[model samples]
Target: MKVSKLAVKILENESVVYYDPIYHGRTLKVIGIDDDPVEVMEYLLAQYKEKGYSIVVFDTSGHFPTGLFESVLRIEEGNPAGLDPLKMARMGIIKDPYSAVTIVQTIYELDSASTDKLYADFVTGKVNSIADAVKAKKNYSEIILEGYTDLDEMLFSGDPVRIPESGLIDLSGLNSVTLTGMAFLILAAAMEERRRVVYGLYDIAVLTFTGAGNAGLPLLTRPARRRVAILGTKYPLDQVLSIPGPTLLLYNDPDVQSAIYESQGVPAGLRAFIDKGEGAYIWRSPETINVEFGKVLKLQP
Candidate 1:
């Protein structure tokens, strides 16, 4: 038997489970007969346990497969529903809307259609079936934020990225931790489809270090579309350390010790919009993304 581990990333406890004989060395019978994506997901889990796979990760929403998988160990669901009801509702996966019976039926058609296609797959918490609702949170749109660098803007302009209405948005590769809250807030605005978001305290604290008084973040569950780009650390002479507002608006301060002829990447002229809160936002207008601090290089141009 080959063994594999599971990751419960969405679960608060962060559990890791391992099952003996992840695989039986030989192909034991494993089938995803269920149609509901969720049920099918559950069915897979049950099968994995019954047949004992060498490695398994239940790649669905927050659901533990039942029945056939009743005896299986070492399986888990990521994207656990949080305490918020809005997120749960968006998946159409409340106690009543989401059920195994409907989900299994749905997967049959989808699996058949997908059998011979070059496609990507996702799990959902849809009201009708399991597969329909997987990743209901991930509705992508062409979002253009203020990109501060050459290659960075290229990434944003070329591909469509997801903006979860809420959750641990990992902008770790894109910007400083200080802007985490702002990044989430901006995404929230886009999710809400607001032309402009009047960010409150909680929204502001989305990236504030622990102990930052941020109880006013608005939890809006609106449909979302778009892409993303955060600017600050990635740009030349960015004032992320000083003037506030996404840490990029602080450049050019008299106190900014940046060497001469440097804009500090802050685009000082943009400070008029910072609203004294040091929060900078860049989610308005056409597909053009610009900050005086950094010059935009055409992704293809």
Candidate 2:
């Protein structure tokens, strides 16, 4: 049950389910029931990586195995290697200077006028990073950048954060919801900007927010330009079903099955076909097929 076999199961049989990125990218929601969604995500991550897709994982729990990736960005407290929005803007990875401001605003809740001025200074090269802002004696700099000393240090530490082609962004170190959301915005903005310049057929971003719960929902509102897979545990049922593209139902909750039947017009008898750990339901565009997930071998440290 390797990922290659799983891809064949999903792609080879077009009558049942078809997933060709060339036709359109997919948003796969992997729901866990008897099995852990993280394990399922790991399996899928291997599958996509093997297929040559550029990967960017937003692991909210930090539980995701960093060994599986070639690079890791740990945004934990005391870590000077954290992401820097200002540096990303300077590198053209953030696309817009205002987006860099938005990242800061998400973290500090800075006033619009202050952020606007910051953005202006950023574009004009008058201010480069948070450290620069503090040094230049900006009016709101102290208030906004007071607690984010590590971030400021990383901003000009001369070690720029490069968005890896295949890597895991560990957000577990960010304890506050605002900080976590800010990380998401920064990475999302980077991915969007990257896709604009170098769009590829198999470029995929796996955003695993299993630990963030309902707070993770807001992060999914942006329309995806490339393939995006969401692995979660507690997303609202309606919102889960409403997500267009393919959906893998590893959970067999009655409410979920009933909702799938009602919304996707799946036959009631098909409910029995979905086993707890092994068998699962895959809802592609016009068809819902019962398929066994590929077995995932844990990566060694």
Candidate 3:
């Protein structure tokens, strides 16, 4: 069944509950969205953590209170994978805003009934390959992100997160406004390849010299789950590693501005090189109004 977006305000006393027929009188808890919103997020995170319900926080407002997650993932500086609607539109691949991407393989007519059903799903999936077909068929990537056109431009591959053995990396040059994007990009991208990754959060900062109280984490973490990607930036924010999966922190060097935007300190060329995980140079954070055309997040740094 196609599920419309469900929003419940899970507060102390005012929330909704869902029941399961298979569980024979068991009910699923729902929360209210009335107050701080942090509590609702925490409750949801706790509920979904062990149950394997992946959560995606659409951070348009730029606040991620992901204290419940075990880890925070981060991506170094880079352009998106080059699979973007605007770029595709510029190339005359599409005529309208509602995007329709063709498969990398030659798509032919499938006359069989089974193939027709599969074709419908694959077309609707917004995936790139057979592995994704199988994964989408399995509902493996539970959290599918479909908002924020600004963030999707950096990817040539057109997927939200790419999973390599090293770790998770955000491929989009959009969403560069906050440091959390880099941290969570790594975490979310890493989780696609594996079950979970670890992150260091408030506790780590209190004990060690990492970060301080609730420094708005990236948007990749869900409640209760532990992951393995550790996050640290040259900026004077606190650091933490609460997730249980493989983790990596940012290089504690000078604050590079290009790392935070698509333009500014970045060189016009070598955009993909930065996306490939070589984020050591090309920054313009020192200047005000650093935004510009041509991928702001450089490839060199």
User: Which candidate ranks first by TM-score, i.e. highest?
Assistant: 2
| Error in Å for residue 219 of model 3 | 19
Q: For model 2, what is the error of residue 244's alpha carbon versus the real structure, in angstroms, after optimal superposition?
A: 3.7
- Model 1 per-residue lDDT at 287: 38
Cα lDDT tens digits, model 2, 1-301, are 2122224133222233323333323455555553356665665566566666666677766566665678877776445653577877887777777877776665565788888888888889998776677676776586676655555464335555677766777767766554565556666666663341111111112222322222233344334454445444434355465656455555466776566556645556555434444434455433334433433233333
lDDT of each residue in 66-124, candidate 1, tens digit only: 33322222111121212121232234322322222212212122343332221222223
lDDT of 3 by residue, 128-229 (tens): 333343345432222222222333223333443323332212212233433233233333332333333323222122222212112223322333323321
- Overlapping backbone residue pairs in candidate 3 total 73
Residues forming the 10-long window of minimal summed lDDT in candidate 3: 23-32
Question: What is the lDDT, from 0 to 100, of the residue 99 in candidate 3?
Answer: 26
- Cα RMSD (Å) between model 2 and the true structure? 6.4
| Model 2 alpha-carbon drift over 4 Å, by segment | 1-25, 110-112, 134-158, 195-230, 234-242, 256-273, 278-301
Model 3 residue runs over 4 Å out of place are: 1-35, 70-78, 81-153, 157-160, 163-301
Q: Each candidate's root-mean-square deviation in Å?
A: 24.2, 6.4, 21.3
Which pairs of residues have clashing backbones in candidate 2?
A: none
Model 1 earns a TM-score of 0.19
